[model samples]
Structure formats: C-alpha cells, structure tokens
Target: MNTLFMHCRPGFEGEVCSEISDHAARLNVAGYAKAKPQSACAEFICHEPEGPQRLMRELRFAELIFPRQWARGEFVPLPESDRIGVLLEHLSNLPTCSSVWLEVLDTNDGKELSTFCRKFEVPLRKALIKAGKLQEDGNGPRLLLTFKSGREVFVGLADADNSAMWPMGIPRLKFPREAPSRSTLKLEEAWHHFIPRDQWDARLNGDMTGVDLGAAPGGWTYQLVRRGMLVTAIDNGPMAESLMDTGLVQHLMADGFTFKPKQTVDWMVCDIVEKPARNAALLETWLGEGLCREAVVNLKLPMKQRYAEVRRLLDRIADGFKARGVKVSIGCKQLYHDREEVTCHLRRLDMKPRPSH
Candidate 1:
C-alpha cells in the first residue's frame, strides 16, 4: 500500500495533515497529505510504493499529537453481492494478522456505519480464520478494515506495538458521578496515554504525593485522591467538599503560577485556563527546579496555527530543561476528553551537576 490512513478528532484533520507531511519530509519520504475539513480522518499518499511501510517503521505513534490511530494500506472497492469474498481474495495475498478491527470514522456518517461494521465483523473474522489469514501469533500485524461506505473500505495493516491499543484511538472512559466536573476524565485519560499500565502500581501508588493547580472543584485532584495519593490542591477558589472529606487533599488558596510545593512532589497536574506558552513555562519551572518527579499539564491552544504553537512551546520546554542540565521524558497528546487543549506529561529522568568554571 502507498497510503497512510489516520483517524483524528473531527475538525483536526488539518493538524493531522500538517503533522504527517512534516514527518514524511523529515524521514525523506516523498508524500503529500490530504484532508477534508471535519472529515475526522486524513491520508498521506507516498510517491514511492514503499513509502508507507518506511514511514510506519520509523514513525513513533506515541509521539504523534494529532492522529489517534493510523494504518497503512489502500482503499478497496467491494461488490455488494459478496463483500466478504472480495476481502478474502485480497487478504490471501497478505501476511497473517494477529487480529482484525472493523473501524469507522468518528463523524456522524461514520456513526451510521457502526451497526454495519459490527454485523460484518463476525463473518469477516470467521472467513479470515478459515482462509488462514488471521491468527494470533503474538507478533503479527493487526488487520484494519476501515469502512468509508458500504461499498468502499480501506484494507490496512498496523503494527500492534506501534499503534494505539484502542480502536479509532479513542479510549472509552466513563465519567464518575461523584467527580465535581466532567474534566476529571482528562487526567484519567492522560494517565492511560502517558503512563505505562505495568508501572502504575509502583509509580502511582498511595505513598506518592501530588499537587493540582487550578484545583477548584477538584476535577484533576479527584484523580489523585482516588488513587490514594495525598494532594495539595492549589487554587483561589473552593474545592469540592467531597474531596476534602477524603482527607487526602489539602486546599491552598493561591495562584497556580506562583505556588510552589513545600517539598518535591511525586506528581504535579494543572488544567488551568491560561496561554499555552505561559502554562508551558510554569511546567518548565517545576521540572527544572526538581520540584516534581512527574507532571501532567494542559496547554490551551490558540485560535490558529495550533500545531505550530504546540511545537514551539514544547521545544521551549526541552531547551529550558537542557540548559538546566535536567533530563526528562516528555509526551503530549490531544486526548479524547480534551477540547481546544492538549495534555502533556513530563517525567524527570536524572540531573547532571554543571561543572564549576
């Protein structure tokens, strides 16, 4: 296949296109991206036949901010009389896949295809297994059947390790009824996206401490409290009484930008409404000063050139840390629960003392 198909939030197709095009150029892959406004997806068509495979091999999906999920392949036209037969014939020429995901876009039209996709999955799975094209070999790629319409589908393959674990790159998280605000899902999803689940027990345990900026109503703080972490909720507004009742939170009336922890904390999370650059600088100060071992902060995007703005802010953070001789692992994502903002995770790796002149 010569195309890389990507699924993103509707209205963000332009960002996805911009991002993929930049990556392709950096990797020396000759390609151009195409996206329709609010289509909820984009495609990168490569000049070379092997361009898609090369990009897939070199690109790190976790580092990509806009695309929720992506696959590499070409669109296939299906006959109404025997769609499964046509797909099976095409599959026979490809390698065995570990699993199959029948997907649709995240738009209304895509929603309409959900029932058809669900009904088509079982029969497709059976047919693939019978044809020896689908097997759980642990190392095989995932088969992605993305339906654009009843007669058109993109037959793609995605490396399980390099793609989003969830279908369409969206995690289904239910909002807690007790959460003071629905914004709680943002932090919950951030953890799922940034922190590896295998390390959660050790790194995100009850013994750890956290700080939540803009903590009024305790949406973000609630996540820390529920995880059994003692938290200092910093804000000039009232926090949720339910959170205070947990005895896990200490509310402080102060400005998030000026507040500093009494001691180094395990985590610092912020969801404050502020300029993207200002928020990033705040995160830099906390990390550069060794105030927190890890942090999850939200950066509200501007009305235009959001991709460029995000890149500039992130680069500024990296440069700031480098100048301070601090090593950190950073990751950013436009999470499912986020709107006009992206969440960033920064983990302190280690620090090297500067040599005296």
Candidate 2:
C-alpha cells in the first residue's frame, strides 16, 4: 500500500525514477524510488504507510511524462502450482474491481511471458468473478496485475479516470500501409494522447490549415492531409508524391527555424532534428507571436539528465507565454512511437487581458 509501481520505456527507468521523486517531494509525500537501468519499470516506496494513497488521489497520471502507466500496490509471491489461488486470496482484501489487466514489461523477458499471461487471464478472471471480487461497475477501480515472473507479480489498483486507457499505457496501433513513413504514427499518437476524441471535429476539422516544418517525405503532413486540412509543407528536401497529389498541400523550400508564415494558421507541427532547447524555443516563438493556434513538436533528448531538461524547457515555454500575456495549454509525453525524444502539444487559449499595473 506504500509503493507506487510505474511502467516506462525499457531504457528510461532512470527518467521515471527522477520524475516520480520530484513529484512526490512536491506533494510532501516522503518517498524514495528504486529502479534498474533498462528494466522498463520502477517503484517508489513511501516513508509513510499512507503516502501512496494520497499520491494516487492527488497526482494526475496524464501529467507524468515518463511513466506510461502506474499502479499502487506491492509484490506478492505465488506458488507455481496455485498462482490463481494465491491471487484470489490476496484480492479478497481489495474493493470490487471493474476489470483486470494482466500486464508485462516491454522487454525480451516480458515478451516471453506474454503467452503465459494470456493463458493465465481466462481462468484468473473467472476465479475473481466467482469470488465476488470482480464486477462490471463502470466507476470501480481497475485491478492491475503486473507479472514479473511465474513466481512473482505486483498486485495493484488504478483509477480508470486517472490512468491511461490502454494496458501498460501502450496503445496498439498498426502502421497504415498508405503512410509514407513509420514516423506518421508519432503524430497520430500525439493527437490521441493530447486531444480528447469528442473535441476532434471542432479543433481538427476539415476547414483548418496547417504548416509542417521539416516536412520532407510528408510523414507528419500525411496526418493533416488525410484529415482534410490544407497544409503548407516546409522543407528543403522533397515531399512524398502521394501527398502532393492531394492538391491540398503547398510545398516550400525554406529553413524551418527562420521561415515565417504571412498569416497565422490553425495548426503548426514540427519534427525537425534539433536540440531539445532549440525546438522548445521555436515552439515558444510560434505561440507567443500568435503564429498558430495550436502546435505539435518533437524535442530530441540529450544523453543525460533527460527529465531535468524536459522540465526546464517546458517551464521556459510557460514563462514565455506568461510574459507575453497569452494563455496556453501545454501537454508533453514520451509517446510510444517516439525514441530518444518527447512529443509536445501546445494550444493557445482565449487571451485574458492583464490587469492595469
């Protein structure tokens, strides 16, 4: 009950630990994180018995950039002969779970356990239901059983509204065959992660216009084009011929960092290869100057202090917007399709005039 378990990219365990430590300290929940490099998971053990419970109530999972999914619980050993029996015995103490997710780490060893988890799920689910510990109440908490091995698993609970919708926080997306490059998934995932589905028709409608910096081959531009938006593709390199055939694109050869549009557009997206701080600055300039109403950008991370750098860059952007007397909503995440980088979504809100000084 005093531990929080988190799932992340295989090599990003350190980043998760750093982020959790910072967040926990901010909430005055004295705790320490334990993680192994490349383990794909981390745990924060609270000094006080009730610390994790308080964190689960106050911490917003979507605000955490590194951890894909999180749960509050402790590990329990199971006898190989009666794994389900042991789990049922322990689950008797928990509230009725709405559903159960049997998860594994995203690693080679984790992959090897997938078949076992699948086979174990059917029977375990039935057992839980028969024992009256599982129900279909939509408001009930989700049971998270993360299997570390055949003999050990982490039993935990996650609030559906506060946690990722997908198991292990990994969305299952198949690459569209018509897409020019696999990179298209990055933008797609960003939209899913940042924008609510109900608001898409209003915010990402067909009547909108967009600009894609470094739009070579149109990997990112493809998303906008398919959604029926007119796009200005800026890149010195060539764009995909298929995207050009759409008759909705205006391709330009120019420097993404220096190019300025004649008029503000509805959206601006950048996936340029550049330093993290530099990319953050570019996004700030766009939103601050009223260049675009909304933006999606990827910041390539450095090898060290990745979490610290992300926070600094985001804070800088927020401070810049405040100085300019503009209101904006910012969201950042290390998307499933992203590697060594994080995706950011910035949306300009209605301007609130500053009071007389």
Candidate 3:
C-alpha cells in the first residue's frame, strides 16, 4: 500500500498526523504518519495490508478535528512532456469512476496550479468518457486527483457520500449587508457545517426562542432573527440600533457569564472572549441545567497545544453531561471565518438512547 493522504489547515499538519496515528493504532492497524508544519498535508502508511479499508470503515470524516479533507490513494508521477498521454495511461488502469475533482495543497504555489487543472479537465473528461470509465448516471467511486505540481499527483478514491462537497473543504457564502458585522458569517457557516441542509427549515422553525450571550452589535443574533426567533441579546455594551428596531430583539445590559434565562428556550448562543475551559463550562451549565434545548458557543485557543485544549474542554463538557444523566449531541468546527477559535454546537437528546461512542 502507498499511503492515505489528508489535507488540513496549513501549520496544523502535526496535529492531524498525531490524531490519525492514534486512530490507526486504536484500530490495531499499524501505521506511521509523516507531517511537516505549513505543508498543508500529511501522509500515513500502514504496516498492515488491510489498513486503508479498515480506516475507511472505522473513521468518519466529521469526527476528525484538524483534517479538512482526505483520500485513500497512491501517488502518481506524470512525465514532463506529453502529460495528457501519461495521465490517460494511468487513468486506464483504475476502476471506473463517475465523477472527478482536482485538488492541490492550500499553499501559495498550490493555488497557481488551479489554472493548469482547469485546462486539463476538459481533455481528461473526454478521454475518460471515450474509455468507458466515466459512468454518467451510475453511483460509483469518485476520483480525487491531488496535484502537488504539474508532474506530481496523487490519485485517490473515496465514496461520494463520505467526502466533502467542496474542493478544498471551503464553503462559498455571500455576506448579507443587513448583518451588523462579518462575524455573522461564522454562525451561518457553522449552521451549514453542522446542520444538514434538508433539515434546516425544520431545525430553524419560526416560533423558536433563543438567547445570545455576549451579543453586542447583534452579529449572531441577526441570524437568529432571520429565522424569526425571539432573541434576548445579553451584553453590557450597546447593540446595533438596526437590530433592535426590528422589535425581535431585547438587549440586556448584563454579564454573559452570570446571566441566566428566565425559562428554558429553544437555543442559547455564546461568543464571549474567554479561555476555552471557561466557555466549555458555560455550555455545560446551560445544557446540564436544561436551560436550553441547544447551544452554539465559540472558544478561543492559545498558540501552543491548541488541539490538546479543545480535547480537554470537550472532555469536561462530556463528563458533566454524563454526570447529570443527560445525552448531548456535541459538534465542533474551525470555520473559515474563525481565527484562533473553534465554534461548537451542543443539543440535548433527552428521549433518545445515548451513544456509547
């Protein structure tokens, strides 16, 4: 076996390598990961022959903390001249695939490779169709070809249902001028990432009520209001006059850490600037005490050991919920709009069987 490659936020390659190494070991699949800081990618090679298939079966992409995109494949090196012929020759040997996506590392040089990919896709598609390898309507494996340069590439296959829809795991969203701050995009992105699109209208019902802790200027509250939710915006500072004018928001001049809703609400959102552990504790209190049905919170990270801190905070939250005999659905992500922080969504599952994993 060649290797399983994963792309992540540049400079966090070490964290991805560490996590994948642990997961591989946990599954009793021996492997070693090679990662370099700022490389934007990592590769894991297994000592066992069936490790790649085992990894695909055992690990879900959403559970990973650092890796944004991944594939199980071997590297393919193309010849300098007559590159199309070399690409076609390699394609002829692989299993039939229905779709294809060309990727590159998230780096300065890697960005420039997109132009070449755009030009190459046309002829590649034609060749694939002519060779009877591109099934138009069939549900088959997706071919992910990651270009390191013009001549160097990695050819991988991952199930379409299990992979990300975006090319580099980045979603394209337009900022609404009505929102007071760009931070509104963070919540929008978080919703898109955690909540499946088919269930959005149901999850964001019009009659929902929510409280926005640290909701100065109403950036996050704007999203809640858009869903027709009555929101209590908590903060000591002044909020955007435009948001208050809508009559859907009530601004409270109170500290977020000490404030509590008068009754249980549908949602609780927090964007306070504090240590990761403190923010985690606040979420724990809200969900554990049954103050809200669901909550979205952001935790700022330190420069060193960012992954470790996230794990510790999540563990604390999980422990608290377990002690209270509650089952909580917890999700976390480092959104494109975030800087040195990760957003988390926690929802209480009172009537459902708690997941052991």
Candidate 4:
C-alpha cells in the first residue's frame, strides 16, 4: 500500500491528516500526509514497502465516510520526470489491490492534459463531448464555473490553480444574511460527496432521531427534520419559527445537558457554545448511559493546539464507549458552516439501548 487515496470530509483536510499522522506514529506505519489542492482528498503515501498493506488492514476510517471504505491506489505522474511503471511496480504488491486514479492537481498546456488523458484512458474526445467542455475541434474543456455543491467537474486543468480545496464557495465568519429555507439548505451543494437522493434517502430512517442543542437559528435542525424524524431542540433561546412550524421537531426550553427526553432518542446533536471537553463529556454521558443510538455534535475550539484538542477528545470519547461495552463509529469535520468548531457524528453500539422511563 504505497499510496492510498483518502477522501476526507470537505474542509477537514488538516484534521484528517493530523489524525492519520498520529495513527501512523502509534502503529509505526511509515508515511506522511499531504493535502490535494483539488479537493478534500488527502494523499497518504508510504515510504516503507509494507506500509500500505499493513495500514489498510488496520485502517479504521472515520464514520462520516463510513461504509464507504478508502480506495487504495497511487499517483501515476510525479516530479515532472518520473516513470509511471516504476511507481506502479513499487505499489503492486499490496493485497487485493487493483487500478489507479490519475490525481492531476494541476495542468499546463494542452499537451500535458492530452498526455494524462491518454495515459489514464480518459477518452478526452468523448469525455469532452459528454461534459460539453470541448468544441467541434476537440481542443477545449474550458468552463470557469463555481458550484456551491461538492460535485466533481472537469474544469480546464489550467483553471484548477489557486482553487480552494474545500470549495465552500467562500468562507464566511457569520451566518447568511438572508433567512434559510429548503432552497437554502442545498443538500446537493452541502454534502456533495454523498450519493444522490435515492441512496441519501435510504440512509435516513425512522429508526434514527436526534436532539439539536443550542438549535436557535435552526440550520442543523432543518437538515435533521428533512430526514422525517423528530428532533428535540434544547436551548433557553427559541428556534426559528420555521423549524417549529415543521411539526417534526419538539422544542424543549432547558439546558441540553439536563434535558433528558421522556425516552431515549436515536441520536443527540449539539452545537452549543462550550469548551470541547465539556461537550465531549456530554456526548460521553449520553453515549455511556445508552441514552441515544448516535450523535452529531459540535465542539467550539479555542486557538492553540486545536489539533491536539481534537486528538484528546477523540481518545476520550472512544475510551468512554469502549468501557461501556459499546462499539461505536465516529467522524469529525470542520464543516463549511463551521467557524471555530468541528462537527462530530457518532453512532453508538447498534444494539438497542437500555429502556428508559
């Protein structure tokens, strides 16, 4: 496993890379993490011969992208003067591995693009015709377009330079100036890595429910409700009237930590203004008590070792679940909507939780 193509959540390159580096150190895998400028994909290229196969076997990917395992492959072109076969031979020994995706981060003249397409069997003329990126002369793939969603588009390779990796359109320190709606929710644009509606809808089921702590403005709640499950909104403040109007949510005017539902819900979600450890503890408590089936919460982080803090919280949460005989899945990402906090999604042991009065 010389090179593994890791797809991190959009805008979470640093967190994913740091976690991988830490895992490598602990497991003694010889590798370093590098960001791919084109998107949230990170390249985990191993220097040691056996590192790829070993790491992939032991790899426990984050839960957000769970069930969707990391695809194992390597970069074909390198250093502007390397042979693709030389690199491929070095990568060949990994078990049950096949195929490589040409990860072109940048392109110069038409020659380079054409060469890459030829090497990858990308069918330049056909792809261009299908994508409408070429002329009758078959010489252009130029389209300077901006997608708020995370779709994969073939821009003129030249146009890829200086692009933001996460593609959030642009970073904003504040919420939107206008009110949000289904139109504003933009599921396609927001979670572009996910498959389209059919698969996405299948992911949603009545078996799962959620709580939205500090769910005032209601953007997060909106996402949950659209899934057709009830959400308990815990906050002293009020939610957007629009969310309350949905009838899929229950507004509870109490502190999130103290407000236990009449029955354990399937999920607990929070975005409260609190320290990371404090939020982590709340998550642990709910998870440990079998109070919920899963959770998607946010922890507001301070400057200085934000990465280290994430490491600490991940350990704390994982340890807590293990002690409780819970098999859990967890993921964290600095979402496009996240400013100084990271979003976490955790699913507790799939076994039914203990009955609550």
Candidate 5:
C-alpha cells in the first residue's frame, strides 16, 4: 500500500525533498520522490518493501493522511471569522483534502451556527445544537469545515479536541481574535512546527537548555520557559516582564552571534533579522565550537527563491556538521503561520559530546 505525507508550501517542494533525502540517508535508508502534480504534493515512494507510515511519522512538518487517494471531511475551528482565509489556504494544500465548509458557531451566545455550513452540505457529524448555543469562552466551534465536496469529514479524526487545521501556504499570520495577548497564532503556528512534539517534550522536561538569539518580548523564550529549561535570552531589547518573572530566563543583552555561552547548552534558537547566510554562519559558529548540542532556528528568506535558499542552507549545514564527525537530524517546514521564512530543527550526531567552549 502507498502512504503519502503532505508538506505545506508549494514553493518549498525541493527543499522538502532535499531534507527528506538527507534524513533517510542519515539513517542508512533510501526512498524515491516525485511531484504529485494532481495535488501539488510530493510523493515519496519507499522502494524497500515496507509501508511509508514510519517515515511519515518521523517527519516534523509533513502530516500523514492515510489511504493515499481517500477523501474525508476536515473541521478547522477558527478563533474567529477573520481566520477564514487562513483556513482556506490550509485546506487547499492537503493531498487528499478538498470541498471545504465553514461552521460559524455564534459566539455571542454559544451555539453551532451551521446555517452557512448547511448550505455547503456539511454533515451534522454531531449536533450539539445546545453546545453551539452557549456564550463562547472563545473556544466555540469556529471551525473551518472541509472534505471532498460530497464526502464525510470524519475519515481521520484525531484524538485531540482543538480540531485539526490543515497546513497551508501562509505568508504571515495575524493574531487570533481571542488569544490572551495580541500575538499572532499564525506566526506561532509556523514556529511550532520546526521542532517535533517529541523533541519539545524532552526540552520541557529539563532534559535541555537553549539560547534564544534575538529573544525580545520572549515569544520563543516563553515556549522554552514553559518547558522548564533555562534560556539565555540574547537581545539588546527588553523581554516581556512576565518572562523575566519566571526566574528560569537569564537576560543577556548582547549580540547573539558574538556572545558565547558559559557552557555547552542543549539547543540554540535564533530569530534575528539578519541575512540568512549570517544566521547560517552563526549556527555554524555555535556548532563548530560545540557551544550547543542541538538547534532550532529561523531563517528569514528573501521574497523570491525562498525554497532554493532553504535547500542551499540545509546542505551547507549538513556538510559542515558531517565533516566534523557530527551526525545531525534536521527538518524544515513552512508552517501554518509562517511568512517568507522557514524554521529548522537539528540534532547532533554525537548525543553525548564532550563539553567545549
């Protein structure tokens, strides 16, 4: 049976392929890929006689949808009506996903406002007519409903309650209507995809320490702090007062590239507004000097050739690490909230390397 993984962003197909190839090769495995023209997705065929689910599960940004050619309904619960466009783009990228529906639950009084949804023939998978009638605690059924025009949307129901939103092409995302702060969920979404959930758990358990380059306002730092890890936030600007209050953060008002950590950290994260190459070099310096064990950083891309740039950088980073007898596992994704940039996650080959500055 053929299983496929759906990667976001049409432009980054080549980069996705390169990253996949490197990942497989690093594990001493092989696979084949070609553009899946019909859906604008990449089809990686595992020539070895096993199913591709294992590989798909290992991928960070690529989502695994089963029964390659099957059609199913998808419900995307938006934070508000404004997110409709984001919902649309996300649905469009699914290899086997289509026929979108919008379920606008009335939040004034919590209720399933499926009037618009009914017009599109959205199946009443479950009618919590009363559920949609209550005043929304900002978590009502503001879902972006999708499926093959005439198919049911419950084919691959996830165990989570947030309602899954497909990873679509996003240039940038504004803040959602009901978040505690005015920060953009779209941007956070993009940033979240860089590091896999598994790796995130490790960091949160105090199994890691990281450096947050250009970490002002502490958005990324907030994520690290919640994970219960110490973060050396390197930035000249002030971080959010709440972040400093956490006591796990060490405010380092200095240049990220020039400042070396007192000891080897578990990870390095950068979000500086420098050229991609400069960011790449900074990562190299950290790795070359063994300042950190692993990394997850952002590369702000130029308007055009964003895909090409990602490919080039990944190759350089991999080559650099390999030459130094360091093995690395890396993945990049154009997340649901990303704009003109991509995020990378890297793990060192030598899990237990000697500490060096």
Candidate 6:
C-alpha cells in the first residue's frame, strides 16, 4: 500500500489534506496530498517505500480531526469479468482479516453502488474464508474495502483498537422517538466518540448534575437527563414543554457565556451556535476554574481555513490550562450529526486545579 485514502465530510478535502500533510511531516515522512473538495475523499501519495506502515503505526485515528475513516492502500482497477479474482489477489497481499467492510464514499454515486456492494459482499466473504484470508475468531486486522466506483476500490487494513468504532466512522444510532429534537443525536454521538463505552454507566451515574448552556428545546439536555442527571438549562429562549414537563430540567433564562454555576457540577454541555474561538475559551475557563468535572461543547466552524482555526483554538485551550496548572483530558471530533461544527469534550482530572500540562 503506497497511497493513503481518507474519507472526510464533503467540502472538507482541503482541510483533510492539510491535516495529513502536517501529520506526515511530523512523522518525518514525506507525502503529497490531492483532494477534490466536496468529493468526500482525499489521497496522500507517499514518497517513501515503507511510509504507509509507519504512518499507520504512528498516527492514532482518534486524534485526527478531519478524517472520519482512513486507509493506506493501493488502488486496483478491477477488470470486468475477473473482479472477484482480482480482489482475492489483493486480499492475499494483506494479513488475514477478522472481518470485511465494503464501503463507498458519501456521495450520490457512492449511494448508487450500495446495492452492488451488498450483493458482492456475500460471495467475497465466502471466497476469503475459503482462501484463508478471513478469520472468524477475531484475531486479525479488519479489511476496509472503500469503493470509489464499481470499477475501482482501495484495499486497506486497520487494527480494531486504533480505528473508528463504526464503518466509515459513521455510527448507526437511531434517534429516540421520545427525544425532543433530532439534534439529540449529535450529543449522543459525541459521548460515544469521546468516552469509552465501558465507562459510560459509571461516568454518567444516576442523579449526576449537569448544566446545558444554550439549552433551548433541550437536545443536549435531553441526553443528560436521560442519563438521570439533574440539569440546569441556560438559555434566553424557551425550552420544550415536553422537556420542562420531565421535571429533571431547570430552565434558566440566562446567557451561556455570562452565566456561572453557583456550585460545581458533574458535566457542562453546550450546543451554542457561536464562533469557534469563543466556545474554545468558554471550555478553557470552565476547566481552568474548577467549575465542572467534564464538559462537552460545540464549535461551529467558518467557511475558510477550518482545520487551522480548529487547531488554533484547541491549542489555546491546552495552553491556558497548562498555564493554570491543570490536568485535563480533551478530545475533538466532527460527528456525522454535526453540520459546520466540531464537538469537543474536556475532563478535568484534578479536583482542585493544579498545574500539569
């Protein structure tokens, strides 16, 4: 595998390319990136003979802001009649895979190929099993087969622990019918992405306290309340009657940025539509001042220099906490449910603020 492929949100290829280019340079590997904006895909053409393996080993998928899913593999143009045979040849080149995911780009043409991919999967799985390329015992890497079209595909592999939890980094979580709005999915996705699943129940215990800044209509608040948290919903606008009816939420008519909690809470969640820098500072303040143990906030992005802007804001937050002698865990992700925004999660490890970067 000589070329690296990544799947990002449409219109974000430039940011994706910039991120990979910087990352590759940091790894002391040279590569050139090419991307078609809004195509939802990008390619990193590596100059080194062994760069792909090293890149895969060095870069942790969770830390990448732009790419939803990525793979390092060569493109194989399948001949019409011998498509299966050609794919088998590629599979033989890779280590045995525990499972296979036949994916396509998030584009109109990609949607059109889904039916064909579904049909192709069954026979391909059988062939792989017969050829000793697929393992049923979950001891091998997972194969990622991203189809650019019916005639072309990128064959790649990723370790389960270091890769996205879902195929193409898109989680298939259904919107709860009882939830107030579809925006609820964004918060749910953020928790899944930033927090390990095994710690969820323990982390979000019953009667945990949380404050939802800009909590009008209660999308994020709904998620916290569902976890049995008592919520202080701050917003100038009215909250949903359904949410208020639950009695778990206290709708405070106040501004998110100006309001400060009278007491420390377990979590502070914000979905305020504001500039990324302001939101980033808000998160830094909350963690720095010992106001909350954990926080999840949304940073709506700008049209240009999106990736650079995100990196700057994140750095400021880290530097501010370091200056304040704080120990914290921070994570950022662009979720499937988010539009023009990225979600950030911060957890303060020190009960009382102490300096440690």
Which regions in candidate 2 have their CA more than 4 angstroms from the true location? Answer: 351-357
lDDT of 6 by residue, 1-357 (tens): 778888988888898999999999998888899998689999889998578778889988998888899877888898877788999987776788898899888889888988889999999899999999999786888889998888999998778777778888889999998888899999999999988899888778665789999998888999998998889999989888888888899998998999999988889999998888899989998989989999999999998999899998998899999999999888988888888999999999877432222
Report the C-alpha lDDT of model 2 over 58-152, residue by residue, as the tens digit. Answer: 88899889999999998999896988888888987889999999999998999999899999999998998899888976568999999999889
How many steric overlaps are in each model, in order?
0, 0, 0, 3, 17, 3
lDDT of each: 0.92, 0.91, 0.84, 0.55, 0.53, 0.88
lDDT by residue (1-357, candidate 5, tens digit) is: 233333334454555455555565665546765553233234455666343444534543233111111112233344434343444344344332212223221132112333445644323322212223212243332332323222222122111122234312322355533332332343355445444456545444465677888888777776667567788999998888887887889998898878999898987777777898888877777876788877766778877655567778877987887788766676665554444566666666666843332
lDDT of 3 by residue, 252-280 (tens): 99999999988888889989999888999
- Per-residue lDDT value at 178 in model 3: 92
Q: Is candidate 4 or candidate 5 better by TM-score?
A: 4
TM-score (C-alpha, index-matched) for candidate 1: 0.97
Those runs of model 4 whose alpha carbons end farther than 4 Å from true positions after fitting are 1-17, 31-45, 60-122, 125-203, 206-209, 324-327, 333-339, 353-357
lDDT of 4 by residue, 1-357 (tens): 266545444445565567667777888988898874435556567888567556655754323221112434443333344332333344334221111123322213322443554453344334434533334443321222111122222121211212223322222233333434332232223333222346444445544577777776676677677667778878787678877888888887888778777677776777678889999999888877877876777788767666788768988999988888878876665544456677776766566553332
Task: Give the total clashing residue pairs for model 4.
Answer: 3
Per-prediction TM-score to the true structure, in the order listed: 0.97, 0.97, 0.93, 0.59, 0.56, 0.96
Off by over 4 Å in 3: 351-357
**Cα misplacement distance, residue 16 of candidate 4 (Å):** 5.0
Candidate 3 vs candidate 4: which has greater lDDT?
3
Candidate achieving higher lDDT, 3 or 5: 3
